[model samples]
Target: MCRWLAYTGNPIHLEAVLFRAKHSLIDQSLHSRLGHTTTNGDGFGIGWYGHPTDIPFRYRCIQPAWSDRNLREAARAIRAPLFVAHVRAATGTPSQETNCHPFRYGRWLFAHNGLVRDYPAVRRDLMLAIAPELFPLIEGSTDSEVMFYLALTFGLERAPVAALERMVGFIEETGRKHGVGEPLNMTVCATDGEQIVAVRYSSEGQSRSLFHSTSFRHLRDLYPDDPRILAAGQNAFLVLSEPLVDLPGWWEAIPESTAVVARGGEIEQYPFTPELA
Candidate 1:
């Protein structure tokens, strides 16, 4: 229903992926090949971490990404070592700026690319599950933001992957209670500035499209003359809802039911499944 990308690596301008990539997020906002909808014009947002702060700065609006001059200028001006950006497609939700993604809490930034099947029927149950302390911060009426709060309530800062598993389990359990057989569909990610934890999973085992870039070191080796790849350095990494470039060697599809943790210097995987007994 939406498209998102997260990057963690050497400091670089936001335009490198948001505007300059072969099939950038801006282009995807108007024409998405992998998203359920062609246009993700309902809204857009970006969150990035910069010098001297573990906290992130967020900018969001209910304007389509392709036509937003503000976004274009910001992308060209801001440089961050880690960032998360999203283009939204309204799916049974309002197009208010509050509903736009890349939601934030303290040092964490999160975004999602899919919906919770039949979310209206189960929204209350899900909302009630969020810790009472975090309930007031729920500014958006989208499942993505709910999921982010649930992760925080379930302990994201201390253990991100386990927190995600707990979040999914709670959603699945809550949905099933409301008779939704296929209740969850998502490819989501959250970052605490230093590390990124992303997951691709659904109750039915079939999830949304997600891929991670090959190591910049290998990419630099493959295209020695490419300035961008060389500039990103060996430690840079990217996880996207779809490949930015059409080339094969640069992107690898993440398999279904997987959680990826990118620690800048390395990428690690763990089998992901809901855990609620």
Candidate 2:
């Protein structure tokens, strides 16, 4: 399993979410309280967009998120209105920079917090399903990256949610054919610089953890003296594999097999299920 977080709203330094929170992503990298693994030190990556540029900037390393000085410096220096950061725990994949999460393609960014059960059984079939144009773009050997490309192959750019549904469906179907009972286990987040879509799903109806922040106004009321909490616009939102803080009413767990969409501070959730491709 892994830990990841996605932030969208008013511009803010990455440190505010990456390092400053009570149990930030960096903290989760060292001591994950909700993940299957306690430590997620295999590798890490961050993807964010800057002003005047729709394409995101991505930085990934084979070093642990908590021990990387470069990541600290970058987090302190860069400010973005939207970003996704991940700390990997290597689910039978190589601990290389390319295997890190927050994989990117064009203006899209994706991160996953779970695994494809018995991936080896379905790897070949899954790879062969990716569009020829997208197959060459896969730079790593992780199921997470393959899932990203699979979603793209199914038209992620045109229909993010539907594409992911079909991708998951394909994965499950492929696994079933190979005799794997439970094929998928994932909490995935993807964005196109305009809207964010996050899903928590699994083939056996048991998924990894995923949470999204409640309205900023509620957070402000909970932390009246915290300037950072008060300064956030009403539209500010965060989605992650775990709650960043222990504050009650500040986070809501995404239901199993559900997709949450956030755009311009407005958030909506829909039931998600695999669709035959």
Candidate 3:
């Protein structure tokens, strides 16, 4: 349905991954190998964190990722310790600025790569579940935006993982109530500048393509001459919809129904299941 990536570690210009990497996010926007579609040209977004602001700065537009000069310039200029980017392939939603990826609130930035199956039948039910105070924050009609707010309503500011589970559980339940089985198919990443949480889950078991880069130390050993590797330090980590390059052993696939957390220069994984109870 879409493709996305998240980065955390030392502060680096977004251009490194979004443009300079082999088969970069910009290239993937036009030639995605693992997404539901080949080109995610409906819209695109970037959300990044810098000093002195708890909230992230966002840039979203309804332009093809490859044609955006502003995005290219911004990528080279903006540097951040943490960032999220998304290339959207509109399932049914309009290709509008508000419908782009990397939605933001407070210090949190989120991006998704899948859909809520048969969303129209379950949209009302899902929106009602969002917290009242946060409901007004919903600016887009995309299911992805709703999912972000649902997480917020379920305490994303505190218990991120648990809140996500609850959000998924509630969506699954609501979908079943409308006879729409298998309502969720998503590989999403959320971050608060402290830690990044990425989940790959689908009610039917098979999820979209999701991968993460190997450790910086390991990568340095593999490509010692690479300046990017040296600049990223030992903590450089990337969670992507697919590998940034064709290099094997550098990117690992996250198994179905799994959750990954990147923090403190480390990666941790755990079983992920919707909490219906």
The clash count of every prediction, one per candidate, is 0, 0, 0
lDDT of each: 0.90, 0.91, 0.90
Model number with the top lDDT: 2
Off by over 4 Å in 3: none
Task: Write down the TM-score for model 1.
Answer: 0.97
Which ranges of candidate 1 are over 4 A from the true structure?
none
Model 2 stretches with alpha carbons more than 4 Å out: none
* Residues forming the 10-long window of minimal summed lDDT in candidate 2: 225-234
